[model samples]
Target: GSLEHTAVLALVLAMALTAAAPALCFAALAVAAGGLGTAVFCPGERRSGAAVFTAGCALGALAAPNLTGVLTLGLAAGAGLLGFLLCPEQALRAVFPPPATPVGTQSLTSAARKLSGVADTLSDIAETVNAVCSCQMPPRGESYDYVVEFCAQHLCQNCARRNTCWVQGYSTAMDGLYALRGALEHNGRVELEDLPGQLSTCVHPADLCATVSHGYRLWCSRRQTRARAELLRTALTEQYSAMATALAQMAARLGRAGLPDPRREARTTQLFASLGLEPLECTVLTDLAGRVTAAVTLPRTSFTPGECRALAEEMGRICRRDFDPPEVTNCRTVTMLHFGERPLYRAVFGLASRPAPPETVSGDACRQFCDSAGRAQMLLCDGMGTGKPAAVDGQMAAKLTAQLLQAGFAAESAARLVNVALGLKNAGQESGATLDLLTLDLYTGRAGLFKAGAAPSFLCRAGVVRTLDGASLPMGVLPTVTGRSTALTLDVGDTVMMVSDGALCDGSAWLCDQLTLSTRLGQSPQQTAEAVAASAVRRSGARQDDITVAIVRLERQKS
Candidate 1:
């Protein structure tokens, strides 16, 4: 058979198949290219794997669209084939893939499991965060089962400064455990430097005491222990005056009883009793689609399982206040999904912006994140201008970036993923957004800020403000990007503020002054956001750009 004649006939056939099955046609063309390359590169070698990979890439290109996507896929297919011819192992590795950047644990298995284990529970954080639902009770009798496990857990135990030192201890312990396990299992595949620095999360005021308090509250209700719990509660409050003081001292001084110390349990019992707060453990989850599926574990109530079903439904609504989902369902049992209040912190966001025409939507968008590992992230995007066109660019940047972060991707990886996605989305069109991302460790009040062509963000701690400015160009405008990232420390009563150019028109110095004043005045995060937006609007006198301000405060909780 003459290959030239066959190539011509195959091209004609592919052209015909494009109308009925474009994806298949693409696959065939990619296979043809890869097969030819393999045959020429390594005459006696088998390259079936490379051919399959090429076909898969072609199918992926169909889903990705754009000339950039198709070209990238074509190049990859060619490279895969060539690589298979030269080194089959490397080619196979590319198709099979390996574990992503490790989280610093020792066991390859544990780290891998941490990355891909609990497949049904959470495959991607971005998808899960989006699924944060405000699901009202579904039609009664409709039910779904979720196997939830606490993917990560940390406890700063036995600390004179439990609240203060516990965070670091937990971080060290988790990191070391992983490092040791990884050494034993993966033989140097995982790196501690690659592991996440720490764990963080946010909890409600009622859940302040969490595990310790829940046990105490339950213990107090018994008629025999009511008098003792009440006395203990009063005494515990006397030890700490304010919530801030309580948080610090509790971390430093609190301990539960075990061995020789008979008073250990009693000590916790009294402390939790004084808090007068209830404990409800809930975490955000995602279904197959990127919708929020909040997993909650109800405490043991005297009510029977049948009776608790209705009660659980009612309580479910209250738990989902942070996530706005359309419907909520319940598993009519004492379900214990993996959840803990480690490294707790509360996150809040606010925006104030006007469109260029005042008819179209503003260009800036803010995304609040509850990523895996109890981490909270605030991602802000501002497009080129203040109109619908700008809004689209900004929304894409914010959303895609957020999803990547939620999916357990690091900031750098997330940025790259967003870049590729945007490059494919707006091939010939010019679209871009200034993205500002800040991740706060709830446990330690440490913040990491990453920027891509964004304005400066502020950090307000103890009434003192610090400014962090951006250092990169906007995303979507570039084929590849690695924005600036820096670590900043926060202590008790710290607030991180982000604003668009419109908000800064009043001047960064002036904005800093205002934030410091707000902190001194003890303004809440929402109130501060409103005040900042109001000031920006006042400065513009109604003629303004799309201005957005986000405030995230780390509060030390009191029992």
Candidate 2:
């Protein structure tokens, strides 16, 4: 718009000048040029094209003669006006076509630049390939200096553009030639007609043969390396998957074994020993034992009665064991002293038997039996590391703790026993296990909590959560010392949660918020867990450490 206006004004002034003074032909020419130039070069109104045009015009006008005289001034003004009025719209349109409609101008420009770079690079590669091919000497050692000289001459001719294309092109051509030569050398000479299709297409067979021969050497050299790495990765993945499956199975088995004190290693050792296995075979057999132990013990701390029962049922199925159905034989009104409330810690029991129940039952079975036998002892342990070793550690901790707790040993003494076992097993090594032992007197609901390097337990009362920070070094790390047990009392509707570090690090606050939002929208736990897991995996950006969580809710006993 500005350019158009300027053109119009210039034409008007030029016409006025011509009308005022017949002698000012130069002024008319200058004004016409200014207007035409402005109309041609000036961009859209938003641009400074019009201002540029005006400045050029003013400078031209200043150099014109007779600017002070009335006649000359009148002529100049008239010429300027005439030039502005006479400037053709058609001429302006020719100078500036309608702006091209583009999806994205910046993107198009970037794409163009990329393509241009690729094209330049390819051209250089082509030149290099041609040079190498042309310089190939025959097997008889015929001189190929002429071909090399020719390539050198071309390189000199295009020296400025050489770096961009020549180096890359030369490298690619050399690679191709090397691959061809290596293939030929390894596979032996093929008839010109019987050569591979790729080789046949090469303009220089000698160079291609040399490349193929070189490639064959490289392939042969690294074949074992590539194969070994792949085999190792596959083995590792299989081991991981097998361990996970075993853990799941073991957890179910422990749940069904309604024994008063189920010992993980005892069961594993017995299982292996029954099969005539050596001591080293114990490692493989017990690979998933600890995980199972941890999973079984998890319910005591983190599961509701209903959930516990459900888990027990699942365990029975996996372990192919039968447990006495959970029965509420008598309603005993019991007040939990910890939170000073009356809650039902129902006495429940079921039996889980494999082909043969190990001499000792798992801690989970013991806890289940305790609930039924009117015993108040719960032991929790998390194995260090992951898979086999960690699972083993956890199993040992739970087994030892459960054994001592059932024997009427105090919680502190039981924890000390477990810690001693862990330290012995992992002597001189940094590896250690953590245990959360709780010996609850079902009759009074008096709890003796022994935390061994486990995260502080949480107590939920009246919808508010409080952490019980009974911090202690995990077992296996150090010798058992005094001052470990944290005695407390529980009340009705007070939920106690104990979990492995895996569970605590499962998801972030943002992820929890998202899960909460999904829950508010009525997403099921299965769905929530799936989403949480997926989101956690995504957020983690890599395979994370193991994850586990357990929640135990205590409710008033049903009369």
Candidate 3:
């Protein structure tokens, strides 16, 4: 309370009322002030602001004060303090409150515009490149000119009968030469008797046929190369167009502002004020999914865990929605609180790996983490063979996959990108690896399994075990990668088991049995994974390979 400011306000009122019956005016003012204080200080009360103001006016008209004015003011102040302490809400509302205005959109619009412009530029470039690439396609097949050109440059160059075949009898020589194309294309070579009369009478007919055959093969190889290059160009153009479209969509989403609730904001503010912390700003934003997020900025203060939980519960009740615990960020002068919607489920992961016999390093790698959207990802990569070289490939694939997924890349897209990276890592030598990816959406309890030349995985629901397998080539084997994906809804206590091919050298029957047993016994994910890996190695005997096993279990999140 500003005591000096209050005194100044009272003096100003007294001076203004001195010319119009000062004593009676002062008495009415005193009663009006007391009733107004009582109404203003009582937070969370349902009385209309106009009703409170009218009641104050009525009390002023009926009451008169003289020497008892001091006692009346003291009692009013005490009652106001008591009401402030007792009321859970601490907001102060005027009789005519201003309209509620939205936040964040004004500041976000500029950034969204810039991003949209960049996306448009990219889209335009992609369209232009795609149009150009589509227009300039490589020739479909081997051309007739290649054989003639090859024969003229290589065979007829140093022949003694070059003049007879070129200048004097150019037309006859061209017909005889063109006739060899059919023979060479059909049989991959031309015999002496297959040539026309003009070419049959050459100084060396056998040599000419051989030369034509070689030239045709060369022309076919060049055509194939050009076709491959064209295909690559088309693929790149499509990728650019897709990237531009994704960016544009992202910008549009960012530009779309979520609705703000003024009632929720006021309640949140008052809640903080009741906790002895006056919020500098309070905003409640709701997304298209109907999830509410309340952001409150308050003067810097220490918040304990219990207080945060209680505050979150209170806020949830105030907004009539369930919210996760608040994420707190403190600055020098203020603390920011953000409360989002809680997920429906939680997934736990466990992994176990072992190197091959006589090897110290394992060729299999794995990574498990939750993405920004709360989707849990499990990546298991197995390289071609055991040892350091294989370890490098496995690690690279797993790392790249994790990073791409975390950066919002789709599962298939991330796997394709990792394949291209591995293929380009080494120039001449061939390298390949199997990639197994499992993604679980905690909010929806949907699980997706993506495999690239990986071994079959087992899904254990209740007491039954089901095998998930797909036919695909390993990454780095070709310029393009092939993969298979499956989606299924998961429930509480459902477990997913994944293993490398090396672990199933004997067969998948044992692995399936192991998964079933683990599920029946209700073992922890870690224990189940370790048991699977150990059983696999024991079954392999002396011819052991690099073994890796990963497990995921879904459970309902505790309230």
Candidate 4:
């Protein structure tokens, strides 16, 4: 290949040597070096004699009749010959190294100015707000005459030692309230007639409610209980009535402040003034009815929102507050929703699993997640078919649902996210799964149900079984989905049972009968769960698919 390449170069070189072009002279020099190499390296190679080559070039040059051209060509050829004789890199570096490019002044200045502009803009925004986050924080509170550093530890409303006192005081008060409620429940019923007789033993109203037992102070029998119960009830009633009234008035004021009247802003301003804190343009969703939600705001001073929330909760111990915990936001703004008198509930859960006829991995997936907030979410996902492939779909749906719920998504929202994720996943796998989710508020014993093409779930409360039918297409079956999302009470000792469709191969009535029988037998929740699953398996017999059952029993937390 190089030999053919050399021949083409040699032909062009010969033509160039006959003219006075610089490129031709360079070509001639390159051809001459190749000839010399061939003559020296290979003796058998036939080469054009130097005398003949020189004569031909001379004749062509004379015919051109251009003395200046002849001189230029001779000089060019000499230079090219020298280049071939020398190292290429050294020669090129010395004669034709590229020039360094200079940076443009205009572009450099513009870039610096642009960066500076952005920095200045950010600085301005920071100046406008008290504290800034990735998402915009509301602007700082306006200047206040009474409270000079209105948002922080230096508030005029609170004395310097107020916080220290408040923290310990609130905790003690809350503890007292919890003790009182526990006492009242333990007593069962109270009478109002023997107030003087009940007060004889207990020194004060606080002592009456908080004291669980006494060498005779805690009324043991109904005969001894009523008189003291009546007195304790009367005392508590007299004490808390004023607190309740204050809470109601405060709630009414908050509601009115949200109205369109011109006095609304003035009222809010005055209210915050009384509280000794500067008023924000908007109180995060708002605080009302004895429950206060401190929207995620930077504590301007040493005072923090959590502390304020704790104070509010302590105040609410006297009266019920409606606290609806805030949903999670993208800005990661921690919002606290409060509901008075709803302490997190405690629950016990049990689950059972049985694989399809011959598959190693069951096509059913069950999961339960409980967060520190006493929020619990349970999921039961059944893939369309049995085996590992179907099992993967079920697991994916269940995992997504559980994770989303833990991340503070409500049942409906988490289900929607799972539905979309399943839809996206379906592009690669044609399988779809039924999602049955239960989110329970341990505080209120309230459970929310979200289902997509799921089987009927059962709730056994006070020995009565209620079936919740979930009518919808399986996840990933439709672009726009429709499913059941409902909330209902799951009081103490109530059991919520969920199962895969395979468990109900025949009808729901059989399972209900089994549940009722188990309830009547006074079986524990774990035993009940096992019995329910066992019954379904026995009913399926030779035609079993994938059987799974999960039961959650709500119970009041022990003191």
Candidate 5:
């Protein structure tokens, strides 16, 4: 009796210990068993075994205490293990020997390949679905129902494997379409008329459905959004291309007529009209048969003899004329005069009268110097912000400064007047304007620079560059802001560049490089300015910003 009881207790203890083993040990054993089963069975048989195991476990767990009773009846498991151990070792070895042909491993390789392929397909589908969700298309009433149907049909066709992925994708797409339809229908009635456009715009419906099916089969799968963005980018590029083509054609058609002088009155009007720009107090001049000409007078600040010659050559090219002789014909004459107690620089050229005969300087000194100097006065004011308010403040400062300067007031006095005007306009808002006032005096070969909260003007001379800083606050904000005037003496080969902060900030280095290159190339002031402006624009890639520049050169007359 004692021996039997001892044997029973040992067996019960062993069974209980095995049943209560740590989760990891149980999991390992289960994995080993599964691997053995997989090795013995084909794919279909393995799947069947997996299904039976899942169903049995579910049923046993649901049966509660009955599972314990079934597990306690371990005689069958013990007998099976005993039989497995007692089986002939030679026969077992023969049954489990490595395959002679590597082709026998095709089952696993084929399954792995299919699994990877399905995973990739599912990933693509998920990306398509996500893209559709993110799409910002306008709602299309009952057209949304059609979209759902379209997606469902594609999903069914692509994911005919009847996997959970297909069902989930179909359901999700349908739900989305229903929501969209509801929103659209709430606003108005849905119609089949809108279905075509919706269908056309729906991207990769079939692929999305296929992905859903594949994802359902895989243990883990993730959904693709870059495709939609790429499509948008492509569309934008196409639109730009079309616009550029049309514009190029138009420009070519306009260029077919005879070249108009950029410097003569009628030509200036025609040129501006052709370019769709506003008319200014400028003229365009052309040579014989209107082939070559100057459209705009070179600003005194950017004028240079080389630029003049280049302009003339450009004109000659258009006119097919011979104006190059004048370049060599007039390179030795020099002239000098005095203005307001300062000796003025001068360069003479045969193209125009050889230096105006010295006459008594009359009229308002500032106004006469500005008007008769063959130079334009420009007052640039940057307000505190963008939009209407800033524009208004900036315009006020510019207007007042121009008015005072044109009325013969000195630069300092003009700046003071602008300051006063701004203060009156925006006394309480703390709004102000920064000023960059430049007076190009071609007659005196000087540029009067006045600034109030603006960067110093840049002067390029003899291949050296220097900045002239101004010490003053912007206008309007302060009750009274004093400004000082600085005179920039010009030479035949010197250039004075004045620009607003907007232009300078956009491409200061490129502007400097362009200036140096233009000077080296011996370009006229106008050419240098235009080239610099164009280069700056190109460097900025057409980032729109306010741009302004003023250039002046003096050319000696030939002996």
Candidate 6:
């Protein structure tokens, strides 16, 4: 069909050229047009069209008189029309196909730019908050001033000798009040004898002592409250700052990510068209690390499992990189499919947990999952003591940590933020949990262990067991807690085992032996975890604390 169109166009142009340049040979022009059309159209089907074009050229060259030439021209034109009508659909496609320009690239760049702007907004808010909080904080030596103000308001305001004690004898009254600081702080009260003679000679010495003592108590309570508030403010400030920095870095990385590959985009578009799927938008973003993420938006429709797999395979081929199956989401007007870079290695997790004696729920919580960044994370938290109360604390900590990590936060930031939340939950009561996290970068096999007052984790590699132990305070005990981080490399067949303190209460030797024996015997991670947890409970006899064991083993993904 395209060849026929080309012939019609070429012949009309030739006629125009002949009229414009009468000295030019008309037959030569026709021959050149045929060769040009052959080059422009597909090769296999060129024979019929080229021959018809050549006949026209030859007949024109004869310059025969009258009807003879006219008949020859009519025959040539009929032959060309026949060739055009017989052209294949495939050949037509070769002549005019999908454009190579990358679709949705501008939209992707705009999204990244918006993210950068959001980061800037967050930074501005954090800076503004930090400035406000800093200004509200009282100076270190102003506690005494608060005590004096309290005494003046609650005691001297009603005293008959108020002017004599405060205004006329201002210096004496101030000195007497300042001197009571040590007595109130150390002994919780001040005696009449503790006051200066000038103030002791007042009409109501006993009342003065009682009122001043009460004010001192109130001042101490106020100071404690302020201290807690200050700690909370500091933690929140740091969290906001950290969040802004992380978001900004992510935005910067994506904002300047390399241009989309035209070849890949064109091939992908063609494949979708072939599959009868009309995509509204399709974009492939490659980061500085060469990691690729593809997004395809289509009219809201469901996809069969096979169709999804087919799309993934076709996309992988187009990009020359393996892609995980697209995660599908349906918005109000469109369906979105997001494909992330698949990791080389996969992890299998196994967990075994049990409550302490006489309790139905365990005080330990564990989670195993993969983050959007392709990092496999396993979390274990041990609460303060065994019971439902402890279980609640442990579960809360683990849940919050998992959510933050999944949201793309750094491990340390998430832990610190959780710590601040727990520390401020109950004003006067103490509540805390130990955090033990194992993060594995599935793409690189690099592993990190982060611990906060939890038991040591054991790593079994090639029949040898290595201990990952660190001494750290539990969260909620302080204003902010920093988890201990240890990094190492892992590979296929290497297993990492984590447990609550109850598992290692009797010491780590038994668990180490169990892990090493299990590895040598080639037991599955689930079996090993169950075996270790049961043995630890048996060793505890009465089971004074909850027992939890989780193991993660790296394995090569089967293609």
The candidate scoring highest on lDDT is 6
Show model 1 residue runs off by greater than 4 Å.
1-336, 348-353, 541-543
User: Candidates ranked by TM-score, best first?
Assistant: 6, 3, 1, 4, 5, 2
Over 4 Å off, model 5: 1-369, 372-376, 440-447, 538-544, 555-559
User: lDDT tens digits, residues 1-559, model 4?
Assistant: 1233445656766666647564455445545555444433442222233333344345444544467756765565456545544645434324322221122221222223223333443343234222312222212211111121221232213545345433545454334333333334446422232223323332244333233332113223433345434433543453244234433543453344221212222333333334565432322222233223322211133435575455445433422343333222221222222222334467788898888778889989999766534577788999889999789778877776665554444555555545555554453246689989888888767778888889999999888999998688877565445788877988888888999988888789988888888888988778988888888888897887999999888888764
lDDT of 4 at 77: 47
Residue pairs with backbone atoms closer than 3 Å in model 6 (clashes) = none
Expressed as tens digits, the lDDT of each residue in 174-256 for candidate 2 is 34333444334446533354444433334445543344444344444455455434433543454345334434543453344
**Pairing residues by index, what is the TM-score of model 6?**
0.69
Q: lDDT of all predictions, in order shown?
A: 0.53, 0.44, 0.72, 0.55, 0.45, 0.74
- Judging by TM-score, tell me the better candidate of 5 and 6: 6
Best-performing candidate as measured by TM-score: 6
TM-scores, each model vs. reference: 0.43, 0.32, 0.56, 0.42, 0.33, 0.69
- Model 5, range 290-352, lDDT digits (tens) per residue? 333222321122336775465455434534453331211111231111011111343321100
Q: Against the true structure, candidate 2 has what lDDT?
A: 0.44
Task: Looking at model 5, report the run of 10 residues with the lowest lDDT sum.
Answer: 348-357
- Spell out the clash pairs found in candidate 4: 152-301, 191-230, 321-340, 323-338, 323-339, 345-442
- RMSD values for the candidates in order, in angstroms, are 34.1, 36.3, 11.2, 31.5, 41.3, 8.6
Q: What's the distance in Å from true for residue 266, model 3?
A: 5.6
Q: Give the Å error, residue 437, model 2.
A: 2.1
Candidate 4: residue 228 Cα off by (Å): 75
